[model samples]
Target: MTVQLPPLPEIHHPKIQALFQKSDRELVTLFQRHPEEGQYFAAIFCRYGQVLYTLISTATRSPVQSDYLFVKTWEYIYHEMRVLDLRVTTPRLSLQSWLINIAAMMINRAEVPPVEEIQYSLKDTPPVFWCYLNQALNQMAGNLRLVLLLSQTFQWSHTRIAAYLHAEGESISASDVKQLLVRAYQALEDALPEDIRDIYLAQPAVTA
Candidate 1:
């Protein structure tokens, strides 16, 4: 004989809908001011939870790893939110990018089984383009490279990056990261072919 399971509790859909109406920045502020009201935090999670999960899953390609990273990322976000200074930390990308950045660091630390390498070269151009890009990235200064990688690869905000670098004994600030990122992009653009440079120029401005 099979035992009957109890039905799941109904979620307050109206409350969730109301939460969705508020912007991420607004929700964050509300949560910060009223930490006891968990709905505000729940609302923020509802907005970006699925997107973050998808990103983690795609990167890790393992259900167990993805689930672990997903939980860890949210934990970091919650802790950071408590100490976050809204004046300095602008949610330029509406907090989604910031969340993804945290997830990326977790992804980087997780050990994954190695996969076979496959190289594919487009027939449209010479292979030197790829080489040039790699060379440009390699030749960048250590600090410049760190800022570029953290900003471009991880989508970390300038203020977050500044704190990370400062903790490592680097004398830097958000303004410095912004300037260094601009210079790094310029150098990379100059190193690329004109056509590729134009494509890069057409892309949207990088949110700090």
Candidate 2:
């Protein structure tokens, strides 16, 4: 079947556009060699960090955790650069997607919002539960966290998430990703306050 691609959104910032043009290896090398280079990297992060963080935070529902995961993602990229090599034909999906995937994995490893606690939310009704739910998910590991963020917060399609994983050299099915995402959302809602549970539940499902 033929697929329809989304309209290309403009990356208007001249400086950031330049950064994106460089290979990941190049950017990482720059950051690693110069202690002061962090300031420059931070500028890049600051430019697009919110969009990335918001995508992550919404998926996991935690601002505090998103902050931590975001920083960790950059560090990992820097560390990976030491021995990593990318072929010219690598799958292309903007640098932000790459970073967001790392952030997601970090959240998954943390394993916050245990299955048992998720079930608890389905049973109880509390005021301002979504706040707590958001907090709990934020505490989870990066992978699961990013999955939720991209699927729920950014409203990306499961196919898109799958395509991203494939680009990163990870093998996962879009259907499998969708299943995990469903569980993540259920857990998130379970953790929310009963008062707004219906509202949260009623919100439109995320789409590409």
Candidate 3:
């Protein structure tokens, strides 16, 4: 016969529960102050886990790769938090943006397979609309196109887009990324007809 084991104690506490209500910055600060608490990090994970998962899924486009990147991104964040000063490294940085930056780096390093292009028949949608859309995309500058793809297609944050561009030896700032996105959208709106533009505008915004 085996002896019975004692039940584990509950980990809940009023102070720890309060961390869930704190802002990202506030939670990070508390975590920095009390590295051993673990609750602060748990709070952060609960807040941003889905956002980062979406970003990773979009970037990898493979369930297995997305799962790996999701875990790796958080591992990188935890390592950085333990080794660096969060106040110095992420001063005034939105937690979502910071997490996206880490995810973007991991995605860049991974070798993701190319997505197969879906060939749509002209009858599927208005051929005129497709033509106008192509023209609009073509009119965008190469850098602007890249920024749009990163922001709209991959659901990257402006900060992540800027950082990725900078890593690729392009001198870009987050403000520049925002401006580029605005210019791209304006160009698309200008190229499309009024009806098509309205249709496009009614589409849901992409988020990461």
lDDT (0 to 1) per candidate: 0.62, 0.52, 0.62
The C-alpha TM-scores of every prediction are: 0.44, 0.34, 0.42
> Which wins on lDDT, candidate 1 or candidate 2?
1
User: What tens digits encode model 2's per-residue C-alpha lDDT throughout 1-208?
Assistant: 2222122122233433556766555664564565322323433444455555555556555444444444445455545534433443267545565666666777677544533333222113211223335555766657777889888667799999988888888898999898878777777656543423433234555899
Please write out the lDDT profile of model 1 over residues 21-110, one tens digit for every residue. 787778888878975344565566656666676777777764554555565566667768766654565555447777777778878875
What lDDT would candidate 3 get against the real structure? Answer: 0.62
Candidate 3 stretches greater than 4 Å from native: 1-17, 83-92, 111-208
- Among these predictions, the greatest TM-score belongs to 1
Candidate 3, residues 56-156, lDDT tens digits: the string is 77766555545555655666686576544445563556667777888888888855433343233322332223444654677777887788878866889
> 2 or 3, which is superior by lDDT?
3
Ranked candidates, highest TM-score first: 1, 3, 2
Q: How far is candidate 3 from the true structure (C-alpha RMSD, Å)?
A: 22.5
